[model samples]
Target: MKKTWKRLNLIAAACGILVMSAGQAQAMGLLQAYEAALINDPTYRAAVSENTAGKEFRNIGRSGLLPTLQYVYGSGKNRAEITQPATNFLGQPTGGFAVSNYDYTSITNSLSLRQVLFSLDATARYKQGIAQTNYSDAIFSARSKDLVIRLTTAYADVKFAEDQLDLYHAQRDALDEQRRINARMFEKGEGTKTDMLETQAKLDVAEAQVIEAQDNLLNARNAFSAIVGSEVTQLDGLRAEFTVMPAKQTSFEEWMTVATENNPEIAAAKYSLEAAELEISKAKAGHTPRLDLNAGYNRGLSDSITTRTQDQTIKSIGVQLVIPIYAGGYVNAISAQAVANRDKARADLDSTRNRIAIELRRQFNALQTSLTKISALQKSVNSSTLLVEATKQSVKGGVRINLDVLSSEQQLVAAKRDLAQAKYNYLISFLKLRVAAGTISIDDIQTVAAYFSPMS
Candidate 1:
């Protein structure tokens, strides 16, 4: 029982450390998420790991330029036998005598070192490793930008759902009030039952809208949670913002220039081109001669009993050179393949830049369109507000029918909805333009959120 408590404490400590880790962060904004993801994201981390492993090629190449040292030792015992005629210094051939030794011991030890003078393959691979590292760094930056776009879309959806839900509630309340007024009029024999029924039916439709809005909100919340690695249970609306977006200072061409220069996709493609060039150089390096130096030491000890025994030690040092002889043209074929691949990489980069420019044009136009719609819609709302008031007064003067007032109110609701949609479109278009301008940073997202602060 005491051991169980100790184990539980240990487990809790581990969990605490895990939560404190950079990658385990809770809900974060787009920029915060970008920072956290750059630190914690598995794919980027894996690329970093691969980059680190690739760097070992530097050491491997440098090894050929450095010395290799070695030491060795051995000991052994053996038996030997010898037969000879036994004679003194006087050279007396007395009789055949034999001397047999049971055992003898031997020991040996040695050390040696060697270094290479020239190796083109090693030089090329070392340079390639440096290039690969740079490539991986560029890829990491691109991934973070991608995360920003994904999270922005998800966050916007949540806000849209929230706004739709609010509209439903507002419309529903307005209809409920109408139904109550109509009910009172009918009781007084001043209004028809049909009027009450119509208001009630509209209220029911608004309630259904609320239900659908709730479902959309839930789905948006889930998407955000998946991206930010945290559950989103609460959402704050941007309420204070009720204005048209200002026009852009720069033209579409200038925006495209900025996007092409700073966008991550273009940067990634540039790096890929560099990597392919390096690979081509690497493959061609295979045709070059490689030089290496190796050294070894060995020692042995032996004991022999019989005729004779001896112990010995051995040492050796050497330099080796390998020139490509022939391998069914594999080297040439690979080098040619690398060249073709480099051409493909370059072409891919061109295609990517073109696609990016097209998107920038589309999004820029969309932003401009949204801004124009917002200005027009603002004017429409003001006119519609006056029209609604005029219609109500006419009804009081017995010059307008009740149905006419209801129709104007319906038009007002529709205009307000159109305004809501305009706001949504403007929000989305502004973000798109920022994305095109390579200004899709967390600060830009926060700026959007700030526009809604008045409502908050």
Candidate 2:
């Protein structure tokens, strides 16, 4: 009896250690994962690079409008030959001819500056550059939010996979225990061979389920690792008790209004439209005159055979005008193309707005439905748990059979799985709703992270 008690005490102590160790396990939360992804996610890194390049657009365009300076220098050895009919003192060409050859060095240096006094094309291009820069900002914003959505999705998938695997393991354990119980009863002649075989069949199915769940978990972990750039041994899991609130906006119209004003995709599309409209002006400028202020200083030495052994310098400044006359109808064709592009941009902007509206509606409805769905699933889990316990008692009391208990256990597992999925769905929907409204940010990530508790 003393040995038995000692064994029981040892078992209890071992279980306590396991529980403590599990509670102390290091875990990654959504915010932690996101921070890691910021430095590691290839897609986000590419977006950052693209944004950096996009910022140069403004500078590139402004350069065309600014004054440009150029300096040129040339030095070369020149050889010249002259053949002429000799002229006598009468200043008439004689029948005899004379040939001469000479070699000299020529040097030229020039500096020039040009500033656009009036150029519609350059002005329109500068405006378009500004608009394009703004568009890039909007695109980056959209991509930034998309990263959050993607990370959250991957994290949720890992969590769901973990939960599913855990439930499957538990189910297998329960079915195995039932199988053992039936085996003992059959050996004692208290249960039939039919009952034992049935329990074994169910246990086999449970084993297969556990195997599939493990595979799913591995796939989920791989996906999560792809975003976080490393394998995470543990992740903070959803809290058993958490609240899911309906969307703050009472109506879809309000969400649409907010999306129109704040959505990054819509903003990007609007900027693109603005740039396209400016493109028309730019194309039309091809047919207009351009005016510029030009200044130059030039120096030359022996630059020509007649000017050999002489040096010259000149400084000049003047206004230059260029008027377009004709160019094989290229200007008109390009102008028409620009008009077509502007129309396409306008249509694209409208399409973006409509798409945002549709997404907002879909997410808003899903969020509201998730709230109700989560509530119902919570109750179902509770009811299923109670039913499992009741069914087990019925089996022991002979009011039900082993099969009934097995069915109840399966039901309970299904209920728990569904509850977990609904919770994840709610979180994803909430985040997506804010994303569609263009209000999602790190704070939203933190808020969502709050729902994850350390593994226990």
Candidate 3:
């Protein structure tokens, strides 16, 4: 009964693995991974949060354009101040006392509003905030683009590894059958020892490759799950596709132009510069005077039981001027810092443009090379298969050695693997191009989905 139970457990485990594989088939794909990242990726969430904070900054500057209001209401006993008195006419020091004291409590309340008459710095600062918000939005979009590329790369790696595993397994299975057939021939005394030994050697090699392929699959899945913010117990098999052709005639200068105009980092740097300029303007305005307008009206009575009589309401309007004076050089230092930051931002913009151009060219070259490689690798795989078959027949006919047949088969397997890697590289390079161009957003998902949809 115990032995039977052990066999039953083995069957159950196999069934579980098959079920899990089926579930994985319906799990999220590369596009879904990217979508999950938008909400689940910690880095992306932080960028979005920072962008939200930037939006609030614009409201702060709105105060300069809108009216400022305050409500004031108060009632207190008016007590005259008394200080030390000098000698009176009698040559004796007079006692310090309140000279005249009367009930002087009045209820005063008002809502005073002040609007800016002229403020250049305030307007500039607001524009700067607007620019900052726009810049953060661009950053968030760029981050999303980067995340998509990452997901694509990771997803592709797992699929590539899986394809390799399949190839290895197939090769191993073929060797297993060869070994069985050779063993049967040896039992019948029709096969030489050399043939059976070579078959056994190949079986060993095939088993080793299977183990290696499995390890690669495990590593690839681990990486994929890490990036997608979820555990990947199994991976769905995918076809080798999703490659795009590079432009036949792409000029470096044109690429640079596009990057400078459309790269989010460049736009963000420009916005940072604009924000710094606004800061300088604000600091410069620190030396200027400000005019404040105010008004108020009050109607409230004191709650003293002894004096139940109510106080009359009072209202007042006035204008006030604020003149700037020496301020410990703080404002000057801020203006200098702003100027320095603006210079740095300009340099960053230039540097970012250079980097973007370089990346575009790199991805373009990689994609082109991979395309050619995939084509060549396909031919090699076909040619290698023919060679392997011919060599196998020749070896069986005693025209070739067993080692030669094994070597040819190994070469064929290697060709298939190389082709798989080249295909994976091609897809990765294509994704890099989209990311470099700053176009890998939800729009990329839509485009990919459209391409994958039924041709009918």
Q: lDDT by residue for model 2 over 249-316, one digit each (tens)?
A: 78888888878888999999999999999999999999999999999999999989998899999999
**Best candidate (score: TM-score):** 2
Q: TM-scores, in order shown?
A: 0.68, 0.86, 0.72
Q: Name the weakest run of 10 consecutive residues (lDDT summed) in model 2.
A: 16-25
Rank list by lDDT: 2, 3, 1
| Whole-model alpha-carbon lDDT for candidate 1 | 0.66
Whole-model Cα lDDT of every candidate shown, in order? 0.66, 0.84, 0.69
Colliding pairs, model 3: 109-297, 109-298
Better of 2 and 3 by lDDT: 2
Better candidate by TM-score, 2 or 3: 2
RMSD of each: 9.2, 10.8, 11.1
lDDT of 3 at 361: 92
Output candidate 3 Cα RMSD.
11.1
